[model samples]
Target: MVSTVEVPEADAQFWRDWGDPLLVSIVDATLRANHDIRIALSRYEQSRALTHQAGLDRYPTLDVSGDVSDRRVSASQAFGLSRAHRDGELHTANLSVIWELDFFGRVRRSVESQRADTEAHAADLAGVQVAVVAEVTDAYFRLLGLQRRLQVARDNESNQADTLRLITALFQEGRGTSFDTERVRTQLAFTRSRIPPLEAEAAVTANRIAVLTGREPAAVVTMLDRSAALPVYPAQINAGVPSELLRRRPDIAAAERRLAAATARIGVATADLFPRFTLGGLVGTQALGFNTLFQRDSETRVVSLGVGGSFLDVGRVRSRIAAANSAAAESLAAYEQTVLIAMEETEDALVRLSHAQAEKAILEQAAEASRSAALTARQQFEGGMVGVLEVLDVERSRLDVENLLAQSATQQATALVAVYKTLAGGWPQLIPEPQGDAMAQR
Candidate 1:
C-alpha cells in the first residue's frame, strides 16, 4: 500500500506575506477604480443627507417676508362722496415658523427609516469591496494557471518534434517503417496546433483583470507580463458557525438594515392617522415709504398657531400602513435567504477543496506511470522489441495523462481560491499605505 501523507498546512504568514503583495495591490487599485464601489459609496452619502433632512421635520421651519405696493381707491356717489385716487408703497416682512409637534412620532419614525437606509447603503459598499477583491484575485490566479499550462504544451511540442526527427532518421536508414515516421510527425503537428487557442485564452483573462482594476486591456497585459506568483491559500481558516455567517456577511447585514427601515416606515404611515400640529409666528413692517420701513410704530407683528389633519383619508392611511407592513415582511424574507446562501457557499467551498486535494494525488501518480510506459516503448521500437503501433499507442497515452494532470492542477487551485473567498467575510482587509507602496514596486 502506498503510504498517504497529508500535505502540511501552509504557513498563514507565508501565504499572507506573499499573497498580500499581488492581491493587496489589485484590491487597492480596484477600490479606487471599481465603479460599483464608487456608486455604492455615493448612494450611502445621499442616504445620509436624506436622514439629516428627515430629522429636520421635527424642528420648526422659519420664513421672513416683506412687500412694497401701490394702491388706488375710487369712491362712488351713492352717499354723495367725491372720487379720489392715491398711490402708495407698502413694505411688509414676516418671520413665520412652522414646527411639527411629532406628538405621534411621525417625524421620528421617518428619521429612523432614513437612518436605517443609510446604514444599509454603507454595508452594501463594504459588500462590493469584498466581491471586487475575490474577483480580481481569482482572475489573477487563473491567468497564472493558464501560463503554466501554456508552458507545458510548448514543452510537449518540443519533445514530440525530437521524437519525430529520430523516427525519420531510422526510416531513412531502413531501420524504421514509413508508418512509424508518419505517426510521430502527425502527433507533433497536433501538439503544436493547441498553442494558439491557449494564447488567446490567456489574453482574454488578462483583459478581464484589467477591467476589474479599472485600466485598459492593453495596459493590464503589459503589467501581467511582468507579474509573477499565484495567490497562496492560508494554512488555517475559521468558518465559524452558520449563525455567525449572518453577522459576518455584509449582504446579510444590509438586508437586515433594510428590514429595520421598512419597520420604521410602518410607524411613519400610522402616524398620518393622527392630527399634525404647527406653531407659526410672523414679524413684519408695512410702510407707505421704503425710508420708514424700520420705524418702531410702523412695525406690525402676528403670532399664530394651527392644527391640520386629513379627516377623509382614513382608508388611504390604512392602505399605506398595510403596504409598509408587507414591505417589511419582504425585507425580512430577503435577509433570511441571504443568510442561507452564505452558508451554502461556505460548505460547498470546503468540500471542493478537500476533494480536489485528494484527486490531485491520484492524477500525479497516473502521469508518472504513463511517462515511464512511453519511455520503455520508445526503447523497444529502437531495439526491434515491439511494433511501431505500440510505440504510437504509448506516446498518445502519455500525452493524455499529461493533459489530465494539468487540468487537475487548475481545479485544485480553483478550489483553494474558493476556500479563501468564503473565509474572507464581507470586507477585504484594508491594505496599509506602506504595503501598497511595496506592491507597486513588485
Candidate 2:
C-alpha cells in the first residue's frame, strides 16, 4: 500500500522542480559535451566496431587478384619450376574463397562475447552520463550555497558597521570608552574579513561549473554572476523499492554485461578444443599471353576442405580454457560486488539526506532564535540596557548559524545528487543501441 502511494510533485521530477533553468542547462551541456563523456562514447564506438568484426567471423571471405609478370629463369633453376614459370610474360588471374564452417560454435560464441562487450560499453557510457549530471548539479548547488553564505557575511558586515558607528558616536560624546570603540572596530574588521574567503570559494565553484559545462571560466563567471537562491528541499521523496536498482543502476548493468561477456568467452575458448573445419576454393586461368589468360583450355579450378586442431598441444588449449573460466569467475564476483555497492551507495545517500534534513531543521530553529536574540541585544545596547559585547556575541552566533544553515543546504543537495547518480537517474534511455540492433539482425 505504501509503495502505491502517489509520489510528491517534487519527487517525480526532482531536477525540474528544484533546479533552475541554468542548472538544468549546465548539466545537459556537461552530459552532451564533457570530455569524459566523449571519451566513453569513443570507447563505445570501438567496442561496436569490434562487435561488427566478431559477427563477420562466420561469413565466407572472397578475394580477386590479377597479375602480369615478365621473368627469365636460369637453365639450372628451370629444372625446379613449371614451363610457365620458366618463360617470360606470364599472365594470371584468380578468384579465391575461404569459409570457416562454425560446426563447433566457435564463431557464434565469439560474436556473442563481442556483442556483450559492446553492450557493456554502452552501459559504461550511460554511467558516465549519470556521473556528469550528478557532478554538475552538485557543483551548481555548492555555488549557490556559497553565494548564500557570502550574502550572510556581507549582511553581518553591514550590521557590524552600524554597531561600530554607534560605538564611535557614544565615545565622541564621552558615553563610551575607547576600549569599547576599539573592540567594536575589531569585531567589524573580523566580519569584513570573512567576505574575501567566501568570495574566493564562490568563484572557485563557479569556475568548476564552467569547466563542467565545457565553457571558459570567464563565461561561467559572467553567467553565474546573476543572483539566485538555493532551492528548497523537497519534503517527500519516493525512492522506489531497492529491487529496481538492478535495472536502474548503470554500473551494475555494465558489470553484469561484462560477466556475460566473460562467460561467453569461456565458450569461445572451449571451442578451440575441437577441430576447425575450413572450406576453400580457387578458380583461375593462366597463360603466357594476357589475351589467353581467360581461354577455356587455360582454366584451372581447385577446392579443398581443411581440418585442424591443437591435438599435439592439448595442455596449452586446456590452460587457455582454464584461464577463460577463471576470468569468468572474476567477472561474476565483480558483478556481485557492483550490485552490493550500488545498493550501499543508495542507502548511504538516503541516510545522509535524512540526517541532513533533521540537522537543517534544528539549525533553522537555532538561526531563528539567534536572529531574535541578536535583534533584542542590538535594541538593548542602543537603549543602554546592555553592553556592545553582548550585541556582538549574539550577532556572531547568528552569523555562524546562518553559515551552518547554508552548508546544510549544500549537503542535502549533494546527498540528493548521489542518490540520483546511484539510481542512474536521467540516463539517456532513448539513445540508440547499435549493438542491440546488430544482434537482433544476426
Q: Judged by TM-score, which candidate is best? A: 2
lDDT, model 2: 0.79
Model 1, 28: alpha-carbon shift in Å? 1.8
Residue 217 error for model 2, in Å? 1.4
After superposition on all CA atoms, what RMSD does each candidate show versus the true structure?
9.2, 9.7
lDDT (Cα, tens digit) per residue for candidate 2, span 1-442: 0011111111224466554788777776786678888888889888887888777777899999989999888868778887767778888889999999999888888888888888888888888877877888888888887888887888899988988998999999999999999988998899889899989888998999888888889977988876577666555456677777787777887899899999999998888889999999999999989888887899888899999877457899899999999999999999999988988987888788789877877887788889899999999888999998888889989989988887887787787687677767732222222322110121
lDDT of 1: 0.72
Residue 356 of model 1: what lDDT?
A: 67
* Regions of candidate 2 where Cα sits further than 4 Å from its true position: 1-14, 76-86, 426-442
Instruction: Write model 1 residue lDDT over 2-99, tens digit each, in one string.
Output: 11212111113323455556656666687788787778778877887777777777778878776777765444323444443343457776667777
TM-score of each: 0.85, 0.90
